[model samples]
Target chain A: MIEEGAGQVDGTIRAVLRDVLGLTQDRVNAFDESTPLFGLLPELDSMAVAGVLTELEDRLGITIEDDEVDGEMLETFGKLAHFLRKKALL
Target chain B: MLRFGPQDGPVVIAAPALFEEANRTRAFLVRILRLLGVHGIAGALPDLPGQGESLLPTHQATLAGWRDAFATAARHVSAVATVSIRGGALVDGPAPVSALWRLSPITGAEQVKELWRIRQAAHDRPKLRYDPARFIAELDVEVAGNRLAPGLLAAMNIAEPSSDAPVRTVRLDTNPRPADLKLPGRPLWRASEPDVDEPLAQALADDIAAWVHACVA
Candidate 1:
């Protein structure tokens, strides 16, 4: 069983954004839950998008369905964090 | 645990190149081993460090790193025969495919370089960014190939047949299976798109199957 903590999940997302996709923490953390990742980050191309999602799935130990993802959910850092927290349970 | 059969002879593993090819050939490669039957066991291919199913957080893997992974997997498998699709360069040795592309190069490597080049230059008159072109040009000057990192060059160079460890090849197609496989003139290779008359696609699936069987047989 995985441990609890929305904060921990936030840390995981931040790490993947920084290391795998090579984004600065300042760049990622600046936006709230409504920021659009695909629109904002030039690096967030299809490969990087898939890669970041894959990294999250691995760390969280849960598979994310394609249908579950909508453009609106990942609009901001906070929303992405919230979505991940929910996904971790799923 | 999907245990491969006959703890003797050699092990055959399918190693394809990146992106679309890997996704396209994965299932067909697996089927090839199944067809091989008692010849060899095409060992399971897990995702690379940063790609496919084995994604891990805080990990960014390079091609050389992937070579090490392949080496590790090869060592772990217990068999007299081992097979890999486009993995010959890593297993055998690095050789450039620049010459092959001299006439008509449509391999993924070329496409990647092209896309990256466009992105680097911001699509300005199809010229890559000054830094990358200069960087790649310098690297190209060092190697026999042109405009590529040494590591990438090595990865692209698979035309060189494997002689380092006695790996075998069994190129297959309709009406003409590999001479060694000794299958009937009309082999049972599945054709996903016969209507398109794409021999390469049909042969790829069939050849992979034959390669797997050869390893077991």
Candidate 2:
């Protein structure tokens, strides 16, 4: 059950990135823990960052405070999923 | 006003999403209106006060003004139903339509919060808190590129979609909110640029057409 919940959070994060950034499913599916986001992805600009965060909150049924958002959380796909896991799973 | 289909049939007055989402979803909404035309439903997309082609300055637009303007447009067209997207749902409540079809409708408070989030992102400061009291107390505030009246923002912060008329809510499959139907589509409103999802538009058009027919029957 725990594993399934964690996977769902990760999948939701991947889907949010794909939908908000207008990325193809294959591109998002290829992302792994080390995949760099934020400044690395051209589509993930500051404006897109707000969209991604809001979409994540909506999908995950969690409210991400403005203060909780930081470059570190969005630094990598893994980090984002990790943050989501902490918020969603707990 | 952009009119589609026959001039005399049951008409659908469309209220496009507000602010930046309006730009992002304009093409998609237009496509839906066009598809609705093909389905034999008359559609009208009007420019509300301070939006689209309206001459009113953005900072001068209040929530009440948008509602009144939408109601006036509906009156002119004799619309039977309203098709509202996102924040547009808030504006269509006062329209004299018997039925309302909303696509991913959001409350005014939610819209204001999203605007603040976008503003914070533009400033590249993630730690900026959204203080609603302080925000509405200020003068005209610039959110994204639009200078919005504080009164409008304050009104939006407490406004809910009007439930006086029969409302059919449709949301995307990714959204867990309760909806009459959840369609499979990415949110065009969140896209970086204006994009058209023809399949989504087609789906929505078909749904709207059927809903309007039922309402008018």
Candidate 3:
């Protein structure tokens, strides 16, 4: 399993955010892990969430179950990274 | 006689589906094109409006509109074949297609059932149980939102083989691409292993390369 705090994890996550979701760097950095992502990002909705998840799945070779996450998990970057690390994305 | 130009290779065009499937698979599509190029297949995947980098058109394009893009692409590439997965089969005409390769083609109500079940599996996280009947009900709505008209919805139903067109299907095989992997949202270990063997991928690329080389020559 990949441990947390790997140097590239953060960059990979941020790249996934900007390139996959088409979000700006400032916008990605603006929100901490605790912020509500779906509503805050506006660009993120049910469909976008699925798209983003799909992009993450393909790029990272991870399996994100719809059942595993929720609106809260999506609320912040820290939370999502935690979920990823928990699932071993990091 | 077919012309052999740098860009004159088979073209791959796909239909627009809702949300993540399209985006996640975008890189995979481009990669396939590049691989085809290495094999002398040099293909092009045109952007359909409202999906990919294509401008988001407000007026929802119908099935025919999307098919027109494939026809347009086919016109440019003479000695060509077409490849598509899922909704892609719906586009363009017979495609003069040398081969119709769909990574995973949905051809029946079972596909509809599976789509809902998969998304519900993703949505109902903690529970982690698949409810087939309920999932199917939800899928109707999920797929419904993507299309604007009823006729188009029926038309987009990729299950109908006759509906896709009169093209000959060389190998209707389904091989999951890296596009099918589950990643960042979940974790690498949690995702399924790559479908084709690494050697197979290299070989598939090589095989196509030989064919394209022969055809181009």
> Every model's DockQ, to 2 decimals?
0.01, 0.82, 0.06
Error of 3 at B162 (Å): 16
Ordered list by TM-score, greatest first: 2, 3, 1
Indicate whether candidate 2 or candidate 3 has the larger DockQ: 2
CA-based DockQ, model 3: 0.06
Per model, state how many residue pairs clash. Answer: 24, 0, 19
- Name the candidate, 1 or 2, with the larger TM-score value: 2
Q: How well does candidate 1 score on lDDT at residue A11?
A: 75
**Candidate 1 Cα deviation (angstroms), residue A70:** 34
Which portions of model 1 show Cα errors greater than 4 Å? Answer: A1-90, B1-9, B38-42, B56-59, B91-162, B167-217
Runs of candidate 3 with Cα error greater than 4 angstroms are A1-7, A29-31, B1-79, B83-96, B99-216
User: Which consecutive 10 residues in model 2 chain B have the weakest lDDT in total?
Assistant: B121-130
Q: By DockQ, highest first, what's the ranking?
A: 2, 3, 1
Kindly report the interface RMSD of candidate 3, rounded to 1 decimal. 9.8
lDDT of each: 0.44, 0.90, 0.48
Error of 2 at B70 (Å): 0.3
* Candidate 3 lDDT tens digits, A1-90: 244444345555675676545666887767566766767776665545654665555445577765666777877788777777656443
Q: Write the per-residue lDDT of candidate 2 for residues B57-133, one digit (tens) a residue.
A: 98899999999999999999999999999999999998988999999999999998998888777767648666877
> Judged by DockQ relative to the true structure, which candidate is superior, 1 or 2?
2
Q: Which candidate leads the pack in lDDT?
A: 2
Winner by TM-score between candidate 3 and candidate 2: 2
